[model samples]
Target chain A: MSTPVLELARVTVEFPTDRGRLRPVDGVSFSVEAGKTLAVVGESGCGKSVTALAIMGLLPQGGEVGGGIRLAGEELLALTPDQRRARRGGEMAMVFQEPMTSLNPAFTAGEQVAEALRLHQGLSPDAAFAKAIEMFRRVRIPEPERRARSYPHQLSGGMRQRVMIAMALACRPRLLIADEPTTALDVTVQAQILALIDEMKRETGTAVVLITHDLGVVRDHADEVVVMYAGRIAERAKAADLFANPQHPYTIGLLGAVPRLEGGAARLASIEGTVPDLMNPPPGCRFAPRCPFAIAQCAEQPPLAEVTPGHQAACWRAPLDTLLEQAA
Target chain B: MSAPLLELRDVAKGFPVRDALGRRRGAVRAVDGVSLIVPKGSVLAIVGESGCGKSTLGRLALRLIEADQGQILFEGEDLRGLSARALRARRRDMQLIFQDPFASLDPRMTVEQAVAEPLRLHGIVPRAQEAQRVAELLSRVGLRPELARRWPHEFSGGQRQRIAIARALASEPKLIIGDEPVSALDVSVQAQVVNLLQDLIRELGLTFVLISHDLGVVRHIADRVAVMYLGRIVEEGPTAQVFGAPRHPYTRALLAAVPGQGHAHAPLLEGDIPSPINPPSGCRFRTRCPYAQPLCAEQVPPMEGTSHLAACHFQQNLPPALVGQDAETGGERLRRLQAYFTDQTQKQGELA
Candidate 1:
């Protein structure tokens, strides 16, 4: 589809733990087209955020990136450290869950936005300042002139998040990676932020990689869904298709566990097991330990195969048609 | 037909808020003019955003913090008259389960010690019986009884929460008030905990007061739901009615806000929530109210109805046929709202 804006072709992110080099993101491959949102949903420690960090080239020390990372037909892995730094804000940006930490307390929100622009674009001092104010306006910050001088401590949680978004969008990056952007926000504020992000994507046509643990957020805003479990893509499909028919046992368990809005006062279908540790995941299928319908074949790692035209699920016993039927 | 288990009549609580100068300039009206009843063996969920005072209302109901005004009656007993010792006795019947399991537990104490502390405090059982009671409590919450010797740190988030539940049940409380019990937990973990609570409710016939922001959780556990705004209940009803067909504009807006509801987003509630210390002149929601008329601005909507309640100037079910209309508009309006917001911001940005 016109060369995906971003692609992780069999990417693997590894870390040096006490035991040895452990792969947190194992042989994962996915892509996002410009103007579309690809949601990665999973429980904690499912390598959701780690995958996002890996894309942004912001991995901490002692961690290594293995495999392909392409951005708009260009190999990001081949880029020099300076080239990667230059590419970051001007072409790609991120907004973390907690804005309080993501933002610099020493600087005003406007300064932070201006700094992002100045570093990547080399804008003049006056021009950078002006752009910062303009970016704040784009994020719907009330009284941009006044807020430009106010420190991070002065803003509310919602406003602080707006500033973070402004910083991420200042240079109009081709890709915006939001990691649990609204996790700390209230429901109403969350609605506003999601609406804002959706609007920005349509206007800028910037591809978005949304990483979150909330299924509702995925349902509301995402164009495509990539369900991950223990460092691998367990299921991948269009958002509409995934909701209509989740073929993976993990996906089914996640949907059933949540209290549905439309259903009659039915019992919540809870998944039975805990999320596995990525450091020492199961030998075969990482999810087989938790799968209710795990068969003898599950002991052999099942490759993520297309269960439908565009829907892929990595499960040995999940009847593709049955899950689709129940969802309908 | 019997009297409700717990009732709060015109309850209010105000906490002194200090200004930047360290002077107590005003009091934040956390919970104001709230009234509701919890039926015997039924669950009542109080739902709202932060600063709506739902959590404070819960704590106030238990007299963990005394209400500045209004009456809290527990099965016809006035909470105000109870002596410290008598209140301690009543604590055995009404227990609170906090939202953060890690924060609530003692890191040094083993699970066995934590569970047994309540038993020792209430003097519910003798020394020998304490061990047996601890094991039973552990098993009741779906934990292996032998793992009680492990410290809270050894358990996962879900397991720690289960331990907390086991400790709460040590007193065999007739009423359990869970304050955002599962908000901090994993969704799968949340489901298991919710299921365990439901099972406990059915088996013990214990009344419950659940305070949560997640509407789905409320819908699952609550027999009745109360919608709160700026410390007051704007709507109350049976779970099905409240969810299936919310009457108030606010309730309708909330139902629309939930993703996957297939509702058109209407400019995602404008402006930040106003300070509770200075609520709007009339309706607290009127500041951000889309349908606010001159009447809404001048007068406070009466919180009305018996079996089901809604506070609004024009509130006769909003032309009943209009129900489920939101489900039809779905993503189109959401897309439009997103575009509008983005464009509007762009203009605002250009202006600056």
Candidate 2:
């Protein structure tokens, strides 16, 4: 197998809160192969975004990142600040959820994309501007030149997101991290943006780390799925396998909780209780408190073990059918 | 048989667009020529994207915002004709639950005081009995009565929503309009609240108007559904029929766009929704409609259906299956999920 474009090993991120250090992302491990999408799925504060930030070495002040992040077998954690900044756009780039906030309101859309090109590729201002227009056109931005000159406020949400994508892909980075890229846009617009990302990946062969809470989005787009609960991976498997045979209780609960567009009305199988507090996380499995299948053994930490080939879950009661039959 | 619990006749609402200088530039038709019926004790969901005027229509039903040209009838009485005092008294029968429970609730007030305020104002219960009624309302919505003394800030999003629901029920309203009530909650918590609402609607025999962009939630709770586009309902029908066989191109597109259905990348509609201030001349959806033609841009399509209504010129000409044949039929996944839920419940029962 080819070397993964981006890899993480035991990535743990800790933040110093007033009470104590909160480990929001703990011992996370995953790799994104070039041209394929690895969806990190979780609810808010599930460390999906924090994992992305840690990989990019963009963790906010007071956040301690411990673990290895590698870009094409090169150690990212060992790089100097300058070296990291240089590699950021050229090797990797991130598209955030809120295009409005991430983008500079003072600058025009063209200037932003051009700035990325200039800083990363060492292109002249005029050359970068031309490249920006080209990138915009490639991303299917209608009236590319005119739209490029428009400021962030002038462009609609979808168009601004396209601009963000254009900027992220301008340098042809091998890795692209999109954190809820289409969340703020409407469904129609969301469809367009997701399609655009998929197209860009196909054309560029860029590894994508799509961080989103919506399982439906993961089902449609991701090659591999990582289900996170309270900063730990609850389950990991191929997208189809995960959907067809979710092993973890949290994953099953999540699937049942989602109201399907095609499904008839039924009482949603809601997971009881909320996400555990990461500040003072419960012992053993983070999901045990909320898991209906939990037993006394669940109080002891369960290793993430393979249930089937390429399918893994972190639960003592994995392969729940067996457990259910025993109980029955 | 009986008159609809609430009805709107040719309802239209327009807000004047003003420049920075405060001069009226033009009028934006937020809700234009919308007419709907809510049968007693039925859940009617208004589904649409942002700026489609679903929220505006919800407010119009409650007469929170007056419609310029329409008649809003509550219990078969025209609300516009009612005096201010009469309207205030009539308000006791209808209540609203907003999207952001945190924002809708008073931060300084305890849950008890918040719930009792409506009872005190409406004189639903005697002053001495307000506390008991508040506790009942709280417990009815799945909150512990002991937590009624806590402020809104102390509760979680779902709990805050429960408090809001409790307050809504405090007035003993016959009808409740929830504008994206559970949209702010996590999926697990959202389901709990949805089940609660469904239970309340069934047990209390209350009518509900749920305004949400989430099709899944709407499908779960709504008996009837209305699909709104730029300020107009493009489709309205029983949930089963509309979702099973979506006739309107926009409706089909919206359903197709949903993620979990294993739909291949099929762009049903393209381009952003046009500005409401200067809407397209004919069919509002024509600009983005795939089947739109010269005729579509020239004339408006009148809604036509006996039981399942759709306002589109090419509704009949549309393919019987806009989505692929392999797409799972509505209700199959839910049935399986329901079975799963039941099995899990039994397991938990055994464990307990």
Candidate 3:
């Protein structure tokens, strides 16, 4: 098999507070194949975004990332600050959730894309600006040249997201990290943006790590799925397999919580408690407190072992079908 | 079915656009020539994207924002005819729940103070019984009565929403309009709140107006659904009919655009919703409608049908809605597993 485009080994991120060190992302590991999409799914504060920042080396002040992040077999964490900066827009790029905040209000949309191109591709301003307009056109922004000259405020949410995509893909980055790219946009616009990303992935063979809380979005777009709970990976598997047969209690709970359009008027099955506090996380399995299948053995941490071929879950009571049958 | 609890007859509202110099430029027809009927004890959901005027319509329904033109009839009485005193008195029956619980709640007030305020104002119970009533309201929304003394800032998003719901119920309102009530919470928490709302609606038999963009939530809760676009309802029907077989192109597109409904990558509609200030001349949805004809660009399509209404030039001849392939995620077993997650009794029973 061909080598994966991106791999993470024991990825851990820690932030120091006055009392103690807060480990939000702990010992996370995953791999994304070239041209395929891997979705990191979790609620807010689940370390999904933190994991992305760890990979991009963009952690905020006093936040330390410990782990090996390999992009195309090259270690990103080992690179010098300057070297990492050089590779950022050229080999790896990210599209943020809110384009309005990420984009500069002073710079025109076209100029932003052009700036990335000039910085990464070393093209002249005029040439880069022209390419920027072309990129705008490629991303299906109507009236590309005119829209390119408009500031971020002038463009709508969908249009601004398209501009962000144009900027991110301007240098043809091999790894594209989109963090809730469509959360701010309307559903119709979201569909358009996701479709554009899929097209770009197929055309450029870029490895995509889509970070989202929306399961429907993951079901449609992600090839592989990683379910995170309180900054730890609870389950990882093929998207179809995970959805069809979720092994972790958190995964099943999350799936059951969503109000499906087809599941007419059925009472939604809700998880009882809130996400655990990361700073003072519970011992053993992070989800044990909330897991219905939890037993006395759950006090001991469960390893993320293979429940099936290519499917892993961090639960002592994995393969819960047998338990159900025994109870019956 | 039942008599309408609230009705609007050709209601319209416009906010005047002003320049930096305070000179009026034009008007944004936010809710233009719209009409709706909310039956007593029924959930009427208005689903639309942002800037589509669903929020404005909800506000107009409660007279939170006055409509520029048309009659707002509440309980068969013209709300627009009421004087200031009468309106204030009538306000006890109608309440609004906003999307952002963080903003909707008073940061300085304790949960007890917030919930008790409405009871005091309405004189529902004596001052002596206000605490007891507040406790009841808190427990009604699934929050612990002991937490009433805490400030809004101390609670989580879902808890804050529960407090908000408790406050809204304090007045014993006959009609409650929830504007994206659970949109701000995580899915797990959203479901809890959704279930809470379902239980309240059933137990109280209160009329509900759910204004949301989340189709799944709307479908699950609302008996009747109204699809709005550019300040007008393009489709209105029973939830089953609208989801099963939508008549309008925009409605179909909206349904198709939902992420988990199987259709991905292929966008059913194109382009952004046009600026409402200077809307397209004829049909408001013609700009993005897939089945839009030349006639649609020339004349506005009048809403047709009695039960399942749709405003389209050729609703009868439009192609069938794209059938979504069910992304089968084991149904019966999935439910049982989910049941175990929420119900501890189920787990204990299994163990026994």
Looking only at chain A, give the TM-score of model 3 against the true structure. 0.98
Q: Supply candidate 2's per-residue lDDT for A252.
A: 79
- List runs of model 2 lying over 4 Å from the truth: B323-352
CA RMSD of each candidate after superposition: 8.5, 2.4, 2.1
* Fnat per predicted structure, each in turn: 0.37, 0.53, 0.65
TM-score of chain A for the candidates in order shown: 0.95, 0.98, 0.98
After best superposition, candidate 2 residue A154: deviation in angstroms? Answer: 1.1
- Report lDDT per candidate: 0.83, 0.87, 0.90
User: Could you give candidate 2's per-residue lDDT for residues B1-352 as a string of tens digits?
Assistant: 4569999999999999999899999999999999999999999999998899999999988888888999999999999888889999999999999999889999999999999999989888988888888888888988878887888998889888888998999888999999999998878788878878988999999999999988888888899999999999999999978888988888888877777666563654677889899999888898888788898889889899998999999898987744422234223433453355546654654111
TM-score of every candidate: 0.93, 0.96, 0.98
- Tens digits of per-residue lDDT for model 3, A201-318: 9999999999999999999999999999888899999998998889899999888888878645368877777788888888999888777788999988898999999999999999
Write down the lDDT that model 2 would get.
0.87
Candidate 1, number of clashes: 0
Model 1 lDDT per residue over B253-342, tens place: 776677654435433776677888788877888878777878888899997777888998878735551232212212332222223223
Estimate the TM-score for candidate 1.
0.93
Number of the top candidate by lDDT? 3
Angstrom error of the Cα, residue B165, model 1: value is 0.8
Who is ahead in DockQ, 1 or 2? 2
lDDT of 3 by residue, B1-352 (tens): 8899999999999999998899999999999999899999999999999999999999998888899999999999999999989998999999999999999998889999999999999899999998999989998988888998999999889999999999999999999999999999999889889988998999999999999999989888999999999999899999889888889888888888889655442455798999999999788999898777899989989999999999998999987776432367867777777778657634433110
